[model samples]
Target chain A: MVETGLKLCLKQDHPIKLDINLRCQNNEILALVGPSGGGKSTVLRAIAGLYPIQQGYISCQQELWLDTVNTINRPTHQRAVGLVFQNYALFPHCSAQENVAMSLGHLPKNKRLQQAIILLEKVHLKGLEQRYPRQLSGGQQQRVAVARALAREPKILLLDEPFSAVDQVTRRRLYKELIQLRDSLAMPIILVTHDLDEANLLADRLCLLYHGVSLQSGTPMEVVTSPATAQVAKLMNQQNIFVGKIVAHQPKKNISLLSWHDRLIEVGYQSGYDLGERLCWMIPETDVILHRRYQVSKGERENPFSGIIIDYMLLGGYVSVLIEIDKKRKMKLTMSVPLHVARRNGLKKGIVITVTLLTKGIHLMPFESLR
Target chain B: MDWESLLLSIKLSTLTVIFLLPVGIILGRYLAYRQFYGKSLLQALLAIPLVLPPTVLGYYLLVFLGQSSSLGRGLEALFGQTLVFSFEGLVIASIIFNLPFAIQPMQRAFESIPREIREAGACCGLSPIKVLLKIELPLAWTGIISAMVMTFAHTLGEFGVVLMVGGNIPGETRTIAIAIYDRVQAFDNQAAATMSAFLLIFSVIAISFTYLVTERHKKYYG
Candidate 1:
């Protein structure tokens, strides 16, 4: 089988600086994850040829879409791109069927309506073909938008926060639909989203973007569990990132002792760091285990510490507990545990609890302050 | 009622609308979307006739299209007739004087459409022309209709510019408004009253229709 993909390298200075390089193979979905004003949508627009970039090279499926160096930029209409706008952008005056049919100009005029109905039906909008955009619910309008985008039979599909406008329930359903839709698609799909969980759920790979820069691109787990930099860790919502000094390296035990808040903590041996080197480290919430008050767990013997619970919030089936680990420095660690376990242990604010931070879960990086 | 002048008024208004539709659409969409160096200045210039006295616009048109000017001579040479005091010249004057009336509403209508919608049209592989025809024009029809109606009504009611530029050549240039003035000058109260009432009713109908469409558009879009 032939390998097909999209390769894009973009650089700009004024009017929102951007330095990004991305690649996505056919049959793969890559999510550009970032906050607003992070140039995620701008990247999508550039891919669709709806926005201009100062210097870039975009090639997809063995065709050159944009090459600023050679001045070979294709016009938006000339590019085979199917983009679902963040707002859906359906034609307000056109019926749902008409909106999809309008994009099928390549087909025979008599066959367009039939094709539009088939496409709409594929998106689960079967009986509401005659309704205009204003008459459809947000979820239904989004389905119509998806149907219209697919009507073009484009070379690449771009989704700009397609699920943001819908309710949470609808978003979950849409996520499932997209995951199923990905199986039938043979082209690269780029999805721009600000929600990390949505990206992790729907995308095959995640590209963390910040201020127009491509920070990291990898599998969702790779980026989440082992971020390349301290900033990437922070962007991944790692709440226990703390500054620590490497005090001693015990090659015999394969562990490095870190001096954190006047305590020597054993972590996985890191061969690249010098002694007394200041570094940043993070422990994922799932790696923090609360020691049972009555039962002694085997893992509780590793890196055990006592902390006063400062605050906690119940989020669905999980309780996010904030514990102040260092009294004078006011250092805090956020741990998420099952609601039932929290309730079983009577976990609440102002309670002193002992928790174990797994040694293997401690990920270290060069210390740098986030701007 | 001066039936000949009344018919001529309708003819002039219809011709003005027919010519102004394409112009209004192009200029309105352009003004609504593009940001050039002199965009605000151009917009202010387009709006000048709206606030300027009709007689002043008429005076400028007279000089610009009169026999003494080079453009007037070129136009005369091209068409084999001078533009001044002619029906053709009246159409030009009406289009110019009604620029704001024809363009403002349509520009606003085009502006009300979100930018993403146009970009989506392109992303769907519709060319720029198709986007304009299939997406933009359909969305902006109400505003375009309102502009046409306002232009037609305003042309029928215009007196000072018509008198200054076209000079009331009875069948050719004497519109209903000019005939009403002519009737009053001749002390014919019945004809003057009849024509005045006809114009008042027509203006009311045109304005009411425009308002109705505008309100419905607002309600639907909101």
Candidate 2:
């Protein structure tokens, strides 16, 4: 297991302060997901000892890697950490075999070469061991970099935007290879990436970071379904977010009523929110049910609202529908329906359709929760 | 034509390059990778030799290493000879005169290497010294060769500094440039013309070799 708590003050035109704490168990992939300049890469660098933090304690498998309070900061080479840079960073002058052998410093010269060849074969670059970095394809170079990182027998693996440089097809193949590699090793791995879908597909847990702060961290489903704040919901691609006021609270029935832009919406009850309190709420596009206005029975519909379809787009397999509820104000909400469902319901622009905002999908947060 | 002067010039240039290459690499690497107070001042000081008249530098060296100075007197007491008007003084002047030619190209070469490559080496558990020898120096081979060739070529044709310090001692400090001047002053136009052509051809060959090697390496590596 690896645990870290770090604080740093970055020196920039406008300095950014970062404070984060996280842990990863053995054989788990903890992905740090965020947008540009969010300090995801900086966290990875700090763990690898490339970037020093002013105050922190980083330990791996009961061994202390860094403890600023105790003044114990091991040099990068002395720490058992492996980092794979975004550009692979293979020695341009060394061949694939020699590059891997560079990490096998504990072995004799001949044994180092032999072990390097073994690692190359494991990464499926056996016959191309003599090729330089320039001669290898992007995927091939990435595999070589991984093999070299593993050659050091590190206790933790840190990958910084590993697959962003490769093509989609190659990235998929590498994902499969990475899963296999992870299965064989018991060490904790931390991956830094900006691609949300990639993180959802690969990581066992996800940490959402913004402006050098980790907003929330949990399993992919928890972070995506129940965001802690409105900013996090937006980062998770929730398009239907707006401010609303608590109009009524029926505690006995376990439901609350919120006033949102001339509409009264019933939502699940949340504690600690008083009547007349302003809150931010979000609904995922997938939970916005689209139905033909004529077929929906009034008694069966829950929180059903009618709006004119202002625009519609057919995105390959699904159709993205944008509806304008208040035409004068141009208040819009977007939803996505499968192409077959859209065609069956005759969904199109300029037509009034009914969409139900699912009660369970309504996530509310305090107005000041973002900070 | 004195063949001994030609041989002496080759020997001097060779020795100067041998001693200058290591010093150049150390200073060049340090200047390329470090930042400190007075760094710009130090760089400017190193570059003065490149712009100053060779005789001015030679005059400074003459005063600093002459018998009257403490350093020269100490050396004279130890070695039984003054530094001025000796082969050792000519070598000292050549090293200072050709320093910028040797170091600037090397510094540029060392700086051209990406930081990621060095960090990656360190991450791979290689020490800083090993990284410099195994990774940085090999990658900077072109710059090193350029520095060596330029320094050697520059030393081969040194005239003003050698004349001031060594005073045109035949077979000792009379390099090709000095010999050409001496032949011209004695009205031996044919010998002077021959030596000038030889120097020109030698410089052209050195520069052509540099270009050819660098081009071939670029193509092969790139």
Candidate 3:
């Protein structure tokens, strides 16, 4: 059996080019998370066959939707795909029952109403069947939209920011309903949204898009904890990204040497690579341990570095110190020092500090372009 | 009592509306959604009758279709008929005269509908025709209805074209507008006022009710 990929590389020059390349799993929900105007919705629209593309192919469950080379573009209805639009474009004149029933035009009339009612009931919109779109509130209308899309029993469900407008309580309830569907339906779900929290809650794998390109695509943890690129790191809201250079590929010793400014450090790398390659390294906030003085430690995997705190911010529970290292080029690190230690030591903006970065906590992704 | 002319004018307007409504909708929908060459010229041409003196249009109709011409002969021979001083002739003239009234509102309505909505319909596997039937037509019904009524009412009040080409027949080409003029010229104010009053009251009530129905949809649908 062959795999079907939802692929796109189009630029009507409509804001963003919407270049996405992903093969959705049969049953897993693939959530796309990004900032506003980062082209999250553009990718969703392209997959739905709404946006015209340039030189791309899309196939779902091995069925070809679009093949630019072959000039094959299946009409959207023929695609049998479902979508719960952002605005829930419910037919205003029709009641919820009739609206759901509209999706079942291919079904027999007797079965259409019954099927529509069942789908509506699945979305918890049973009693509101006779109500028109105007009569429904924002959240209620969103549920109806989902029901109508599912009424078709489509091959894949594409939701374009469905819960963006709903209240938090209603959004939570909606997520529960979606989670139930996740366990039951083998139909792949692709939800596009700008909210990271929504992605964390809904997506098994998160795909991030930025300015018409797939910045990163991986499980939520992989993208957040150990992002692959600087763009991915920025999109994931990582505070500290410092430039480092590879020093030694000590394979026998199981420790790769990296130089952070003038200080030499040893960190773990899954593979040994060439030397002098410029790399971007990340020190997660949880990794940095603050100290009262410029202390030295030996016989430990933790590497120590010294710098004066250029700026300090008192967060709720942690103190963030912005440290500048004197290298040939300026290097800044956002080291989150716990507040308890700060209070005990009375650390200030001009205070000289020593911080230890654990070998395990250091993430290294090669930035080849920077060199 | 020139009741036949009055009745004929009402029939003419009614028939014109019936034929022109769909034509207007198709034209409007196409123009609003699709961009092609000479669009501005075509739109201006469609609205020509609204601005041009009806007498000029009537004369042009006669020039191309008068009995003496080969074109007129060809039409007469092809259909065993002529389109001058005939009821069919007046109907044709009225359709052309009131074309813009049927088209403008419908175009505005189609323009107002979001293209994303059409794309949404298309993504649901609705073909262009299906999108038009399901999404475009129903949504644009208010403007369509307004177009029909306005065109029909405008045709009802037409005079100059019928006078130039119609020759005031008793029960055929002589419409109410022509009859009013004829009554006024003959110094028959009573009959003229009677026709005028009927025309005024009927048009006012019809237009008022059309506005009411259209406005009701706007208020309730949103």
Candidate 4:
């Protein structure tokens, strides 16, 4: 029963409980993104057959790796999985070539070393093949681990925070290498990480998890901007999550009216919710457009509001400004603008500013307490 | 020194180490990685030989393998011989007495390996036996060697258990330690001194070799 993808549905309540359902097509990269202790790594371990689930059905390429009802479970080595651990657990006593060669046991003995050398070169570690894990730098050791994992030419690849140990610069370089490598790999790849930015940059789709429960799975931007629930919104770092009521839906104008405290915001058509229904809504910081102080702009005409700057922080080239829109409600909105734009507008604490929330970016979710 | 007794001691120590090597590895790895019911109790029971008087352990072994017990009688029926007062009996007692010496260092070594290394081995498609041979055994060799040395040295010097279970039979159970005691009992101080000095030197060399190898391994791999 050989197919071309992976499907894993697992449920367990004891001993590191988790509920996860995930799928990946051939050549797809799915990122399991969540907070620490959110069972992202556990999911990877389960897929790799290192962790046992009390009840589950796991199949790779339509071959059953685990089926609890039938009492069929394959041991880790029998499953065609290549897993890169967070610590890059390269054999300390083995050289980089030996580490990669260890995984090439399926090949002829004489060809193992040549294949390992090729894999090491693929990871840009050709000259360092003789170095032991202890002798290599963290980044080099990580590359050796990746080479070792890929040496098996496994049916699936699992990466558990593969870039977390390296410095930021090295991490960026590894991310680029992995992205380049993915094009050559036809197997499904699942990555576990707490870094949303890493997922956004490297993964084709992101699966959001919280406390071992998968909340949503979608493209990076969709999950970030149109989270299915408040929890997903919070997990995505959407700072503008708020509870609002659908005051009206104007079908003729293809618009909806959302009442946030004393304000009426014009949003894109949301057809499902009844009038006066309470719902959770969020707007991404990218969708909050800062109005030019010196000159008015046409983009400012949609969902325009004035607020006073409560806080502002410069992050690299962008300035994140938190503005309080309602003094009595203590409601605030966060927006990011380039540093040059902030400076030109004289943005600072206690300064009054006007911003427009894009009508299409006001995403709505079913009512849930923002606890 | 009684060359016959010294040779007997060497044979006994070598046999004990041979038998305990696999036992120590299997038990040590089990203790290192698993959690189960009665695990602590099993560990405490295994450690009794380290703290309890050798005579106490010997008394139990003597009774368990003596002629009056069913196990001893069954063994005698099967082999047409008694186990007590024999070289085989002495080896068994020595192995039991050196259990901690044979297992603790290896257990600590196995524990020192991070869990992810073994998982990585599995993920790399190495079978469990291959992982143990290519990954765990190489990493834990220092502790395994230490265990062997400690077990050999301890088996060579055991006195009370040998006396109780093997009954001072010359050329059979009269180890170097018992021979030293016998020489002293016979008012032969010079002979006792010779055997005692030999054992002292052998022990020093064995312990020093273990320490040197362990220190070198740590420096190279720590």
Candidate 5:
């Protein structure tokens, strides 16, 4: 069991206080996803011993890394942890092979270079030994950074957005290599990224942080389907956030009936609820179906939400539609169906549309202010 | 106006430069990395020698390190030496006079480096000493060298501190400035001209070397 609770304080103009209490299971990649400057990187830095913590303790595998009361603050070099920087930060002065050899401590002078070569090969950076950082491409530098970190043989690795500097194609390939690396190693790696897709595909457990607080943390599906608050839902890019309350609830059932403002919006949920209790309905964008008329669903099992299209973004691979509800609220839905669905149905702004929330994708989460 | 005294002054300055280079670099690195409550106070203290009257500093050192004091007695007991009226005393006086000239630039050099680079080294599990030896020192070379050159020039050209501590002992404490003053006092204009010529040549070489090194660094960084 791995448990760590830390209060992170950064030295900006005002100290950013992030309290992270997490029990990350062994061998799980816990991805902390959040908005920019939300202290996602702070938590990673604190755990990695790159940032100072003000209060609480960090323990991994029953071994303490930090304890304020005990005053056990092990410096980074002695902590035996691996850290991959955001920019990769491969030494500009050193060659790729030498970069990895730096962490292979106290090895015989001649044997160190050979050992670094083996580690470089593991990262697929073959034959790039003599190449300096400036000579390597963004993707190759990232590989070198990972290889150098792996040379330390750390029990836990911390990566801070390793792919943000690369192009889309390179990022996809690096992500693949990272997954392969994880499978072959048993050490738990904590990754921080803003990409929802990356978080879902790469994480065994997803930790969503917002405004310097861990708002919600659970399995990727749990956080994705039921974000703890409206801010997290927004971070997840949920299609619709309805200001509603529990209209009817079955005591034995986990899900309860909800009404959005005045209209009834049926959703399938598995959380306790009290009737007349105020809450928010989170409907997935993929679950929203765009239609010309309200009869798109044949049966009454359909829960249609009436709204006007506020925006229609025709991205090359997908379409993002923002619907204005009752001329007051907004809903952003993403769809990637055939073009004929919108063209044949004449989907346009100021036009009424009936959308069904794939009930399995719909979730009613309680609302609370984090600030 | 004696030629030998002026040449001897040049000798003392050259020796002074040789001793202060390593000392200044280490002190600069320490001041940059150490974070204590009195850091600012210490910095001001390090810089005071540069701004204070050279005679005042010499007078203070003379009393504290004189033969009558415990420190002077302890030094004599350990090494059988005294600082008064000795070449060693001149070296010590020059080092103190030009210390800020050597350290201020080096401290600024270390300061301009991005903290992330050192942190990156630390995160890579490099020891603090390794970080200093491998990353910090290499990055701060330009400043360190410039500081060395400035210290060398200042020590070579020192007048007031050497005047207070040095009693113009022929071939011992009589530096080029003292030689020039003695010649002028005796109305020996021609000897003064020759000594001035020697000082002029040394100044040109030192100043030109400083300019050349600085230009190369500018081009390299640009």
Candidate 6:
């Protein structure tokens, strides 16, 4: 396992403060996801000893790489951490095999080349060992960079937006190769990326960072389904968020009544919420169900409401429907429906439809946690 | 024509380049990558030779290495020789005069190497010095070669500084420029023309070699 806790203050035109703690076990992929300049890359750099931390400890497999409190900071080369840069920083002058051999510094020159060839074969670059970085395709260069990094025999691997520079087709292939490589080498991997879809596809755990602070970290499902804060829900692309007041709480029944826009909305029970306390809640677009106004029975529709479909977006197999609720205040909710479902229901703009917001789909957070 | 003067010019230029190369690489790499409080001022000082008149620079060196100066006296105590009006003095003056030519290009070459490449080298478990030798220097070969050639060519054409510090003393200090001037003063235009043509051809060859190397470097790496 690799563990890191670091705090860094970068004094640029505007200062950035970073405080984060993370852990990754063997055979686990921990993805750091955030907006640009949110210290996602800085966390990886700190773990690799590229960025010095003000105070923290970093250890991998019982080896102490950094302990700032005791003034123990190993140099980057001395630490057994491999970092694959976004740009694939291969030596432009060195061929693929030579680049990999460069990492095998302890071996004799002949043995180094032999080992580098073995590693290159592992990355599926056997015949192209003599090609320079300029002669290699983007995907091939990235594979060579990975081979070079792995030649160091590091305890953990840090990939910094490894696939951002590749095309979609090549990216899919690289993803498959990366999974195979990860399986063969059971080391902890930390991937830094801004693409949420990529994180969801590859990572075992996700850490969401904002303005240098980690807002939430958990399995991808937990982070998407049960966000810790409203900001995290927004980061996860949850669109339907509203502020409501708890009108009443029925503790024995495990339900509550929330007053939102002249309507009482029934939601799952939440304790420690005082009566009339303001709260923010979100509902994922996928959990929203739409039915023909005449079809949904009155008793089956939990929180059904009729609204005009103001806009709709078609995305291949799915359609996003935007509805303007019929209330004195302006409130719009977005819901996703399968293309077949949308077609069957004749969902279109200007059409009045009924949407049920399921009780289990409404996730609430304290109003004070908005920031 | 004075053949010994031509040979002396070649020897002095060659020895000066050999001495300046290592010094230039170290200083160039340091200046390229380091940041300090007075970094701009230090860079300006290093560039003074590129703009300052050679005679003015030579005069300053003359004063700094004269018998009355402490450094001059210390050297005299150590080697039992005065610095002025000697071949050694010409070497010193040439080194100071051609320093910027050697260092600026080397610095530019070192700077042209991407930082990620160097960081990757370091991440490969190679030390900083090894990274410089194996990765940085090879990648910057064009700049290093250009610097050496320019310094050699600049030193070969030295006249003002050589005359100011090491007066025309036959084989010891009478370089090609000085020899050509003497021939012209004595109304031997034929010998002077021959010497000037030879010097011109030598310079053309050195500059052409530099251009050829740099062009090949660009094509190979681009």
Tell me the tens digit of each residue's lDDT in model 1 across A115-157. 9999999999999999989999999999999899989988888
Q: What is the lDDT for A129 in model 1?
A: 100
Which tens-of-lDDT digit does each residue in A1-371 have in candidate 4?
45678899999998877888988988889999988998998898888888889999999987899999999999999898888899999999899999999999899999999999999998888798899898999899888988899899898888999998999899989898888878889989999888888999999998998888989999998999889888899989889999999999999999999999989999988899999999999999989999999998889879998999999999889999999998799789999999999999999999899999999889999999888
Question: On residues A1-371, what C-alpha lDDT tens digit does candidate 3 reach at each position?
Answer: 56743443454455456666776786788988877887777677767777668767888877888888899988777887888899888877678988888788778879988888888888888789999988998889998888888777788888999998889888998899898987887778999988886888889898887877778888887888789877677778777777888988777878898887777877886474568888888867667766546344452336866677788898778888887655346666677767887777778888777777788788888674432
Q: Which stretches of candidate 4 lie over 4 Å from their true place?
A: none
Please provide, for model 1 over B1-222, each residue's C-alpha lDDT reduced to its tens digit, 9 standing for 90 to 100. Answer: 899998999999999999999999999999999999999999999999988999999999999999999999998999899999999999999999998999999999999989999888898788899999888988898999999999999999999999999998989999999999999999999999999999999999999999998889877765
Ranking by DockQ: 4, 1, 6, 2, 3, 5
Runs of candidate 2 exceeding 4 Å displacement? A1-16, A292-300, A313-316, A368-371, B74-80
Q: Give the per-residue lDDT of model 2 (tens digit) for B93-199.
A: 88888889989989988988888788888788888888898899998889899899989988888888988888888877788889999999999999999888988
Model 1 chain A lowest lDDT segment of ten = A1-10
Listed in order, each prediction's TM-score against the native is: 0.97, 0.92, 0.86, 0.97, 0.85, 0.94
Model 5 residue runs over 4 Å out of place are A1-16, A23-27, A60-64, A235-239, A250-255, A269-271, A292-301, A328-346, A369-371, B1-11, B14-19, B53-84, B184-222
User: On a 0 to 1 DockQ scale, where is model 6?
Assistant: 0.77
Local error of candidate 2 at residue B177 (angstroms): 1.6
Going through the candidates in the order shown, the clash numbers are 0, 0, 3, 1, 1, 0
- If both were scored by DockQ, which would come out higher, candidate 2 or candidate 6? 6
Q: In model 6, which residue pairs have backbone atoms overlapping below 3 Å?
A: none
Interface RMSD of each: 1.0, 1.3, 1.8, 0.9, 2.1, 0.9
TM-score of chain B of each: 0.97, 0.95, 0.92, 0.97, 0.86, 0.96
Best by DockQ: 4
Question: What do the candidate models score in CA lDDT, each in turn?
Answer: 0.91, 0.85, 0.80, 0.91, 0.75, 0.86
- Those runs of model 1 whose alpha carbons end farther than 4 Å from true positions after fitting are A1-3
lDDT of 4 at A285: 94
